[model samples]
Target: MDYLLTEEQKMLKEMVAKFAKEEIAPVAREFEEKGIFPQEIVKKLGNLGLMGVAYPPEYNGAGMDNISYMIAIEEISRYCASTGVIVSAHSSLAVDPIYRFGTEEQKKKYLPALCSGERIGCFALTEPSSGSDAGSARTTAKLIGDKWVINGTKHFITNGEEAEVCVIFAHTDPSQKTKGISAFIVEKGTEGFRVGKHEKKLGINCTSTTELILEDCAIPKENILGDLNKGFKIAMVTLDGGRLGIASQALGIARAAIEDSIKFSKEREQFDQPICQFQAIQWMLANMNTEYEASWLLTYRGSLLKDKGLPYSKEAAMAKLKASETASFCADRAIQIHGGYGYTKEFDAERYLRDAKITEIYEGTNEIMRIVISAAMLK
Candidate 1:
């Protein structure tokens, strides 16, 4: 797969991998245990021009390709899943929509700060009543005078607690359902908008998966993203890129599990010899590596399609589906190989398992991925 990457991309990968190993790995466990966001690391990433790898330099980004972005996420997630998502949710979920659909004014006003990590951003679509069925969201918005008044409670929003900017989805006409949904850019300190309950998750604990409450929150009419009554398309398109980001994260997790298991098998003694000598352990390691390579290739294919500006919704779904499941599979096998130590807090195998589960659930569940893939095929 290294042959698939351009020289610049390969260099980017090596640089990010080094940064993650040196900066993120030392603090990953402590940060997750305490639920502390890696603000400094994010700032460093921004300064290194990694926060917006795929965007152009005019927006203060690295002006790299999509593969570079995926490589960065994978390297970062290899050390810390929580930090991986913070970057993903900010770049793919939040910045991408603005860059793709925003007005020129919006781009100039937001992209620089966001790409520079001066301000964090989040995408708010999921709600208490709405998860996979985004069309059924109950949030509502109405135009008044010079403002659009929005009212909604969006939960499970990554980077919610720290996000200074949010992309919100709401219904302009509930009678029309999905067709009536619209996107809005709501800045922090907007009237009547506040961060809500913080969730205690099983993994990715350092991330702020919290609720965003909007009670008659009002923003300028120009704050509307894309077009009125066309937000569903925007959401769907944005998610295609986001799924790839998650897939890359999953690939990192799987790699972590595989690498750790390989290391442990050789050192751990079983009946007077290293456990790596056993066929069972060897088979597990072999399967783990094979699945990881498959997932990586899938994810890279999707990234390549995106860089070429092709329709990649189906490819993204497939990559996400396979990579997420592989992450869980590899993590479980890593735990089994580590025996009792893997189950305990002393080792990271259990943490890997916990982190891998969410990849299957978020950025559209595996069930949703199946629907997307099958729908594409049937069509």
Candidate 2:
């Protein structure tokens, strides 16, 4: 199997890398410090077609392949993971399911605004009680005449407060368990749909994350997404794509840490010589480079599999597992290389470390990724 990136993918990567360095790298620290969502920069990204890189051009997207999508994600993530999450969550987690399952009318009404970045989209599936056990969601959607009234709360929803549209999952028949779930398109400002307090997260501070409260929120029957009782499957399918995006994010963070650490080691004087000349520092750099390269290969391979229309669930999980762990490790090592300065916000290393930790927690935790890989092996 060929592992090389296509010329188009290479160009896409170069474009995003340049954009990240020039546009995002400069202001990442300020955003993190203020914990403010960079709406202006996000809008700029939308104009560049980074918001919907993988969707079709007919839907106001860039019409790129999965590899290009991953490249864009990695480049954006390298500079600022918060922005990466905002873009990745919208594209892979929210818009993808709608594009894949929505009726032509639904797509027409939603895809244009989302792809153009005029409107942001969010996915709401994890409830306070139902995280890894998504099948046990407490959110309910009850049919009442020609409308469905949804009542439930979704926690830790990325881009929740800022999203113009939300793809939510609810249980239509509790007795049916996972089979009872259904997806719905709920626009912001719908009566009874309230955005809750913003979460004080450990990382990805610039990405708006909050709870979604649906208190008897009503939507027309036409708003239902996909077949009735098929929302669980849709959620899982969407997560498969999201895992790939998270893997790309992890790869980017790791790459950045490695790059920074290498540069630091070359310039940092220790024992009257550059630290990079020391075997100890060189060994750490060597291990970091080796692991980062491995993680990138896994991430890119998963993207390629997705582009080929193949089953990429296991590959995506593997990529996420390896890349997230590698990112965390690389960030820790970067901090060590920088000594006391790394522990401070003066450098991006601390932010990378914080951001890398969340990658292992979100988009299916590293533990969950292991389970997926093991289950696939058994299958």
Which one is best on lDDT?
1
Question: What pairs collide in candidate 2?
Answer: none
Look at candidate 1 and give me any clashing residue pairs: none
Steric clash count of candidate 2 = 0
TM-score of each: 0.99, 0.98
Candidate 2's C-alpha runs over 4 A off are 1-3
> What are the per-residue Cα lDDT tens digits for candidate 2 across 242-300?
99899889888998999999888888897999989988888889999999889988988
Q: Name the top TM-score candidate.
A: 1
Give lDDT: candidate 1, residue 328: 99
- The models' CA-based lDDT, in order, is 0.95, 0.92
TM-score, model 2 to reference? 0.98
Supply the global lDDT for candidate 1.
0.95
**lDDT per residue (tens digit) for residues 1-379 in model 1:** 7998899999999999999999999999889989899999999999998778899999998999898999999999998999999999999999999999999999999999999888999999999999999999999999999999999899999999999999999999899878999999999999999999999999999999999999999899999999999999999999999999999999999999999999999999979999999999999999999999999999999999999999999999999999999999999999999999999988899989999999999989999999999999999
